[model samples]
Target: MNQELLKLDQVSKTFRNDKGHAIQAVKEVSFRVMRGHSIGIVGESGCGKSTLARLITGLTPLDAGEILLEGNRICGLSGKAQRQVYRQIQMVFQDPYSAISPRMPVGTFLTEGLVHFGMISRKEAGKEAERLLQMVDLEPQLSQRLPHQLSGGQLQRVVIARAISIHPKLVILDEATSALDVSVQEQILELLVRLQKEYALTYLFIGHDLAVVRSITEEILVMKNGAIVEKLPAKTLVRDAREDYTKQLLSAVFSVREFQEP
Candidate 1:
């Protein structure tokens, strides 16, 4: 068996109202992600899927529990340690249009982080940026254009390229393909599969669509009302979900497909 690359032990998060009413966003979520495998988290909006992503990425402080990377606690790290953590864990958000700056050229967007971390010099970044763009199947010239100049699918590939440029051990893709057209979504998914095989990447893919999640992930986690209600192999999710919520979601997805078929 592969050694666990990441672990969440009873991880929890809460947000309190001004009146002191605590609303739990994530409740004691626990899981392990092994190297070179993908775990999918699926839920409707407001089910704490995005909050879990935020907690994993250190965008927010954890109110409770532990997050570990390679058996080391990642919570409460100093700035220097956090920067090191970032090199191991990266995220690609849902919207390419807003995820990157409109004013920054694609080359700058891809290379700035590498240069900031002293991994590569500014002079060497251009060639490295072009290399990454090629890895994502984009022409090197596209790096000269701004974010707004590319179509949504093209910008998303750039985002994926930047996320992988640092060679992260784990990549959290929170609805990374949700913004593109259906055909574009398939292309991006294929690209992700290729990249993962080439890089041995462990993915934490968060999305609402069961079909999309099932297509790329090995394990599927079903969340409802801020808690995981079911966990199953991706191949069995539609046929063997023990939770009504999971069944309902699967039904809805299939219903739409049937309704749209010619």
Candidate 2:
């Protein structure tokens, strides 16, 4: 039987805007992520996908809800406890340039987490960093270069290498490939698939693109207006989706594809 890796029970979050207006970013969202499974959360911008990612990663606190990682509550942890939880749950954000520091060498960025967690000594990090780069299909020598010296795809690969270097149980990718061109995006997606199989890593992929999400995940969650409007298998999304919002999203993707075709 597949084990449960993560669970969110009635998770909700509300943010106060500049004018003090309360915005319900996430509303009673509940879901389960099975070990070694890939689940995708798909919606348009402002549909609360990113907020949901933050909630899972503990970057943002929840107003009312429980986030359980391996059956332990992770919503309200602090200090050392929180840091420990973070080691098991890593995140890759939308913009690779912004996710990494401009001044840091790629190798240091890849090995910093491993060193901080005492997984490896400072002297051992260099070889391990090179190994990680190779795992991500990046040239080991590129690790000596700064972030600006690498292309967007290469930098994103580095970010991914860093996330997995510590052997995290779950990875939350929030628009991870949206910043790259189509070709680069495809390559990254393939790399993620291979990595997942190699490491038995569970993934929570958040993105606005339906096709991309479907290609990578086993199940799909459709969100609209801060709530999950539908949940269905990725293989049958178009055929199984019943929500009007989901159909609308499908229509939009189809229209865009048609427009782009010769």
Candidate 3:
């Protein structure tokens, strides 16, 4: 087993409605992700799975506790230090269409981070973007096109390429395959698995589908109502689930064909 890559200790978050009533989005969540292993966070919508991803990636502020990367505190670092820490993690959102700007050329989009990180010059961005596109199984010429020109699956691949262009150690995939056709979903998931092995990248895969989560992750965390209900190895998820929510989720997965196209 690899050493701990990330640790979240008693993390919590609260949200306020229009009337200013408090709603706990995440409640005392705690976990550790070992290096080079993919961990799945499965739950129904509004369960704070997405919020947890946001917290890990520093997109949103944590209301409590600490988020550590490689045992270093990551919650409050600022400026270059903050950016440097964040550069180690990348995010792939569910909707590629909305995730990227429709107006920017793919080449510019892919190399923006590389340029910002001083890893490459603007003059070399095009070539590097082409290389990244090919790495993600996309055609180099596609980099010249806009986001709207590509299919959902193609765009998702582009998003993956962008996320990895910076060579991140961790990738947070928030429902990354849920919006595509089932076949496309499988292809994307397989691409993720291959990328993971090739780069030794750690993944924080968030989704509502039990079967989908089980397909790629070795360990699973079940969440409901903003709290983690159980944690189990993926192989034993169906057989060893103890919580009613976990059983209900597993039953739902088994009730379906589990492979039908969406």
Candidate 4:
């Protein structure tokens, strides 16, 4: 019995450049994320994947259509209403360093959301932060250190911990592992899989790498020029993708992998 957790109905966004040329960053995209399922959106840069994520998270205004979370309208809500809706959604960006405050201690960063949302007392936040760090397989003591003191992988783990701290219903990962080393990326992916199972989480993973996206998601959405050109099961994408654009992406990824092999 699968449940629908998030829905985007003909969602669209447009941006104007310096010359006032309209750019349809996201154009009438529609999708549904089932509860406790992982869906990946993959495309090259400037293909509107990130913009779509922003629209879902309510960070950007939509030019058309609606976004719903748990059957409730999430877009265009005001102040407290918006914050309440957003608390159900969390995002992990490509750069962990840019996602977190450099000046804030790691523990504070992890627990701030909890405290702000009244999930825990200030005194209890320390222990909760440690627990969150442990959940991500990071050292509890690392929570006391600044973001700069941790490695890229460690910082990303911290960011992930923070995102899950409030127990969001949908987690949007926008190229979350692209900035890490290959070995580190594997570790992070493993962590994500574990967390999703443990928390009964739903993921909306966005990235440019086909292989990586296939490895993590149940279904893959192929985006090109602000529209989804293909949607297919992850296991069959390499063999069954229908769109020419999707086939080209697979070819490109295969070629890159071949070139990198020993």
All models, RMSD in angstroms: 1.6, 1.7, 2.5, 1.7
Per-candidate local distance difference test: 0.91, 0.94, 0.92, 0.93
How do the residues 137-194 of candidate 3 rate in per-residue lDDT, one tens digit apiece? 9999998999999999999998998898888988999999999999999999999999
TM, every model: 0.96, 0.97, 0.95, 0.96
User: 1-262, model 2: which lDDT tens digit per residue?
Assistant: 2999999999999999899999999999999999999999999989999999999889999999899988999998899999998899999998898988999999999999999999999999999989999999988998799999999999999999999988999999999999899999999999999999999999999999899999999999999878999999999999999989999899887456567889
Which tens-of-lDDT digit does each residue in 19-54 have in candidate 1? 999989999999999999999999998999999988
The candidate 4 region of ten consecutive residues with least summed lDDT is: 250-259
TM-score of 3: 0.95
Q: Candidate 2: lDDT of 230?
A: 96
Q: What is the lDDT ranking, best to worst? A: 2, 4, 3, 1
User: Higher-TM-score candidate among 3 and 4?
Assistant: 4
Give lDDT tens digits, candidate 4, residues 81-112: 99997789999999999988899999999999
Displacement of the residue 149 alpha carbon in candidate 1, Å = 0.5
| Selected candidate, larger lDDT, 2 vs 4 | 2
Query: Which residues of candidate 2, in runs, are more than 4 Å off?
Result: 254-262
Give the poorly placed runs of model 4, Cα more than 4 Å off: 254-262
Please report how far candidate 4 places residue 23 from its true position, in Å.
Answer: 0.7
Using lDDT as the measure, the top candidate is 2
Off by over 4 Å in 1: 255-262
